[model samples]
Target: MFKEFKEFMMRGNVLDLAVGVVIGSAFTAIVTKVVEGLITPIVSLIVVLTTGKTS
Candidate 1:
């Protein structure tokens, strides 16, 4: 069972999928930060200016 599990993990497709998941998570984090740091503030400012309320 252990050897079979090891072999499964060692497969190229499994490794590639694992790497892709990690990279995708990292890219999501970067995009999230960009939106929070830049876009969110601009949107908030526009909303406050138009509606005269803070969200």
Candidate 2:
């Protein structure tokens, strides 16, 4: 059982999947920050300009 588990862990697909998940998580965080910092503010500015209201 232990040998089987070790073999499974050593397989390329498992390692690739782990790496993909980590990279995807990091990318998601970066994208979220960009949206909040840049896109969100731009959108808010456009809204205020069109509506002439501040909240």
User: Tens digit of lDDT per residue, candidate 1, span 1-55?
Assistant: 9999999999999999999999999999999999999999999999999999995
- Per-model TM-score versus the true fold: 0.71, 0.85
**Candidate 1 to truth, TM:** 0.71
Highest lDDT against the true fold, candidate? 1
lDDT of 2 by residue, 1-55 (tens): 9999999999999999999999999999999999999999999999999999877
Ten-residue region with minimum lDDT total, candidate 2: 46-55
How many clashes (backbone N, Cα, C below 3 Å) per candidate?
0, 0
- Go through the candidates in order and give each one's C-alpha lDDT: 0.98, 0.97
Which regions of candidate 1 deviate over 4 angstroms?
Answer: 1-7
What does the lDDT read for residue 8 in candidate 2? 100
Q: Report the Cα lDDT for candidate 2.
A: 0.97
Clashes of 2: 0
